[model samples]
Target: MASVEKVGNIEPMPKIYPIGGGKGGVGKSFVAASLGALLARHGRTVALIDLDLGASNLHTFLGMPAPKDGLNRFLNKHAQTLDSTAAPTPVTNLFLISSSTCSMEIANLFYAQKIKLINAIKKLPFDYVLIDLGAGTNFNTLDFFLTSNKGVFVCTPEPTSIENTFRFIKAVYLRKIKQLIKRHDFDAQAKAAVLDTASNALTSRDIMDIVATYDPEKERFFKACIGRFQFKLILNQFRKNADAGLGKKIETVCNRHFYSPFEFLGGVAFDERVIDSIYAKKLYVKNYPATASTMELEQIAELLANGQPASSLLQPAL
Candidate 1:
């Protein structure tokens, strides 16, 4: 948890948004960069940390070369603090903590290092901290995403991407349930239910059943802790031919089945020019403001900034 000193009263912690999905090539980095830029444009201090580990490339999206000082320096103890590794981006009010400087073995961070990094991230002084996670549901990725309940999952409209996204969501949800059980010292039955022989075979309902039977108070506490999670989903590379209501439909399904609230923050229209913008080393939202994809991104950025749903703006674009 983030700790704050009191000047007169406790200061509000930065709103951390970990952008991740189960698969790569889903525009996770693009969305993170665009959202960071948009939020900074709104006069909020934003820090974009590339937690992509072995596959870091977020700096390119911001039209800047990789920075020499980044997470690697802090992780290696060369930097005293994680914030010390932060390098300013070309965008005003935006900072970048690239992982490009990390060694090849950096992806497999040790347990101690991971915990230290997580705690340091929480201490970063910024209005908004956006972490661009690498692909997959690895323990590290899932833990990073869970560092804040306000995770933004990005996926495309393709069946495979959507399937991977669902898998990612399940992994994250299960991880949180296990943490709660351990934290509150649930009975052996509850632990067994969660750690069945088969991998990820137990659902939230199954564990909750065991937990409720063991202790109703713990069950309620677990439910409340899970319920407090506010997850947001975004669809990328959306084409007109694809189902426009797909995001909302997924959101509905997740809400009905899971304990946490899931909000679909609309889709970014597919545009080939995004590739062109990338090749030219330019920020798409900055150079192509009038494009369909950019406009959609802007709307998503606004919704994130306001931290509320604008039903009219959230309606699927036809």
Candidate 2:
């Protein structure tokens, strides 16, 4: 177990990656733990944060009991920084930040409180900060989801989950666009006017129309920002040959509708050992090392670490 002190400072600001899905029970927590574990196995210090404030279970997935301190304590000023709530898990080179117990108040954290929490997350010492965001598109989840250097959206082959995942992605994109516009000297009334139009499911052309009327340079900048934002998709619980096509379909949908091409990261087939390990309070990567699921997880981890193109791995299912 590596202590926080032993983990030297992450100079130059480590990259933060957030894993989020629009709906719950799609194995977001499981992916977070497995990826963190794999990264740790490679000698990189990893911090797994359960940002699902009310329903965090990353600790459970890692086979550890919930910590006495968590994000809630930090938010309520019961702890100074998120590092103060960090607990050493059984995995080497990995640290855990559990979510506080369910709290109605957590759902109502003010904007200032949320900013404080994010700043604390940035200050944590680690090479990689993987945030397992809470499910849904509420202000809390969306804010943290978009704050990372990269965002991974996990969804299964189910229709409802895919639709909600699309919604979540669109919401984040629109929110970022709105923020950029406001930051460009657009006052509250003007900003609300632009957002109202964009809220009606406006197209890129529509955005150009509104922005061209005000500042064409800002519009160009907005388009460039949209192009630069990074989003990756992972299809989980795949079981059949046809199930693999769902990933490309999602990518196509995102590119066609949202004007943003999504990198189809990879897929994980349905493996019984994943569930068995969860029930046993152990990570499959450690407990079922040779399983197919573990192999696929390793491939995904490599893709994330090296920024390798996943197109080669996106083969048709057998």
Task: Please give each candidate's TM-score.
Answer: 0.90, 0.85
Error of 1 at 142 (Å): 0.4
Indicate the worst ten consecutive residues by lDDT in candidate 1.
1-10
Q: List the residue pairs that clash in candidate 1.
A: none
lDDT of 2 by residue, 1-318 (tens): 112112234432556889998999898998999999998887998999888876777887898888777677777778876787778889998899887563756767788877777766767778888999878888788878866637899988888888889778867876666667655665444466677854777644555567777666566677776776578888888777646577887787777766555788888888888888888988778998866777788778878888873464445245
* Candidate 2 lowest-lDDT run of ten: 1-10
Write model 1 residue lDDT over 118-208, tens digit each, in one string.
8778778998999999999898998889778799999999999999998898888788887766655677776776667684578666777
- Which stretches of candidate 1 lie above 4 Å from their native place? 1-12, 192-200, 308-318
RMSD of each: 3.8, 5.9
Every candidate's lDDT: 0.86, 0.77
Error of 1 at 9 (Å): 13
Candidate 2 wrong stretches, greater than 4 Å: 1-12, 101-104, 187-190, 195-209, 309-318
